[model samples]
Target: MSTTVTPTIKHTALSDFKEITKMRLSLSVVFSSVAGYFLGADTISLKIVLLLALGGYFMVGASNAFNQIIEKDLDALMHRTKNRPVASGRMTVNTAFLIACVFTILGIGILYSINAQTAMFGAISIFLYTSVYTPLKTKTPLSVFVGAIPGAIPFMLGWVAATDNFGIEPGTLFALQFFWQFPHFWAIGWFLFEDYKRGGFFMLPTGKQDKGTAVQIILYTVWTILVSIVPVFGVTGQLKLSIVAAIIVLSLGLVMLYYAIQLYKKMTEKAAKQLMLSSVLYITLIQIVYVIDKFIR
Candidate 1:
């Protein structure tokens, strides 16, 4: 009789690296950064755009990886996040920590090579996201507000990377994204209320997905719409939007508002999901409109 030996497969560091980065989310973050770069830069260069996107991706990815490491236990409790690499035991805490460190350093270094202002913003985003927002999620509903600071930075960071200065242009970009986040996240909170509760996260402003929360969502949605159209008035300095773009953006906002109202009336998972989808479309469409208006006008 002959005995056969089976070879054991060892996990590669590269596979673990991908898991820690949360590639899908990183890509989305990079998209926003690139959109901001396009809108802010006077002349868009492919090389700079690529660098900003990659740098933004690594910075946001590092924040997310550290967040997972910090919230691994809580994540295990939530069905939506239970299978995350760290929470599921597929990646160890030490491994995740090292990956976060590497990404953070690489991200900041790349951004610094472009401009120091961008690098500083990137570092601050990571710090606020990981050090403040992650732990605050379970302690207070205000965590969303705290997280928005870092979340809104990407758009402005792109501007700083290109222009090497922070002014009305980047400020407007920051404000638009800042207001946009409230509705986007609240819609998500509405849909994931149950899952969030499992992890002791108070994501909704009212701490419950009820009429009050829905009202707040609508209020913020209105504010976001107003800010998005501000540039059309041509008073926002370098960041100006045209009448056509304003109309297009307003139409998208109305669609989002319609879904928000529907969610308010029905207060069901389906309605919340629709609102969430609409929120996503509203942001993306408005960003594209801003860039288009910049070139057209």
Candidate 2:
């Protein structure tokens, strides 16, 4: 006779699973992929949409889990991450690794059901995030640039999933999201500099809050806005935004830019937090507006 895993250990593992996966963050990334799918899909099926969401969530969860596994010791040193399941000793590295393996296999299989390209990109995003970006955090600020590649993939992944092709349209969408990540993440880095430093992660462009960092944030905000409105000029192949929708996107970009400018001026935690919120709003609303335009026009 053998004793089974106890309820206490089981419950702890379950809770630790959620903590290690960073469920909310994973879900947010999935939301971007869903928006991409909706925009690229000509005839949306409930089943495919659901599968995309599930696959996306699983992929991001796996990436986050692997990142935590790699950084468990470092995470234990930072107040922001000290309570994370693996960092807190609530879960073993072996358990986390097994969970990550399961999520990765399921995620890739689900995306493959949509298309091979989608599956391949999903795998790439996880690989970049876990294998590349995770290790670079402590080495160089250029890690943010490396990290943005994977970060930007989901938005275009949906388009690829729907069309089963990589073309100018998805490329444009990818460019827009890629540039947006700089300002979005830089704002977070600005506010959380101390917490990140505790973990030996230097994310800011200058690795400190200063004029140079603020200027780069503003510049990226400009780049993100320009890429977003390019479809209005009808340069892209599949994606074309109406003037009205472009105007709305432009207005939202201005709002984000305003916050970016404010961060440069104030250089305070409040301003950085405000910019972070604006970046979130800008991306979410812009994606929604684009999908709405696709349907309306």
Candidate 3:
């Protein structure tokens, strides 16, 4: 009985840690950084890739942990987030704070070993996320814009880690992600508007699922698609994309655009959910295409 209980308790603790870190989301963020690293690196070094992935994960985890700590009560109010470790009362604030601190220290330290610039960007991302974005969630719809800064950093952060420089190439990578997030998040905000409202979050541009919000989503989705193909125009420095890759990327964007249009025309929860999932697939596939094109070209 004692042995079984001990194992169960340990398992629960492990699960709580995963929840606090938002492990799946953190891994996805790390994937962006790794892809950027590959794109920017002249010669791939497994050591740098490993360092970037680990440090990137730690930084994203710290931001999520801090966000949970800050929004514990608000999270409890929302049905979607109510079961979170902190919001559910299964994890104490102090424990979560300790984990956040450890992650922050280790993350920055590891990134610093890569380059001062990489560490600086990582620190900025965490600061913006936990300090500005978390607080502004309930205040203004502009919070999404502010949040996009940190959210867009991982891809560029990889380029910086690989090259130790901030240039047109990394900037292009940053712009592509920055624009993509608006439509992705707006789609989510559309479908989950009520759940977010329960938590006092005003995520949509119009604060309601209206034509005004749908138009902005469509506009930003177009902007994202355009930025994704700009590399083919030979204007984005070292970030050149082959014509074939650009066409594939354009096709992927069109698929997302179709869903965005469906949401606008239908204005139903189902359409919004479809757009949300399509946006996820779009970003993931676009990143993969960019990396593969670089290596094969």
Off by over 4 Å in 2: 1-14
lDDT of 3 by residue, 5-104 (tens): 3433333888889989999999999999999999999999999999999999999999999999999999999999988899989999999999999999
Model 2, span 1-297: residue lDDT tens: 998975543446666777888888888888889888888888998888888999998999899999999999999999888878888887889988999999999999999999999999999999999999999999999999999999999999999989999999999989999999999999999999999999999899998999999999999999999999999999998798999999999999999999999999999989999999999999999999999999999
Model 1, 270: alpha-carbon shift in Å?
Answer: 0.9
Candidate 1: pairs in clash: none
Residue pairs that clash (backbone atoms under 3 angstroms), model 2: none
Worst 10 residues of 1 by lDDT: 8-17
Clashes of each: 0, 0, 0
Q: After best superposition, candidate 3 residue 159: deviation in angstroms?
A: 0.8
Global fold similarity of model 1 (TM-score): 0.93
Best by lDDT: 3
Residue 252, candidate 1: C-alpha displacement in angstroms: 0.6
Give the root-mean-square deviation of each candidate in angstroms: 4.7, 5.9, 4.1
Q: Give per-residue CA lDDT, model 1, range 1-297, as digits (tens).
A: 999999864545665566678787788778788888887788988988988988998898899899999999999999998877899898889988888999999999998889889999999999999999998999999999999999999888887887898998889889988988988898889889999999999999999989999999889999988888888787778888878889999999999999988988999988988988888888888888888778877
Candidate 1 scores a C-alpha RMSD against the true structure in Å of 4.7
Best candidate, TM-score-wise?
3
Clashes of 1: 0
Candidate lDDT values, in order: 0.88, 0.93, 0.95
The C-alpha stretches of model 1 lying farther than 4 A from their native spots are: 1-17
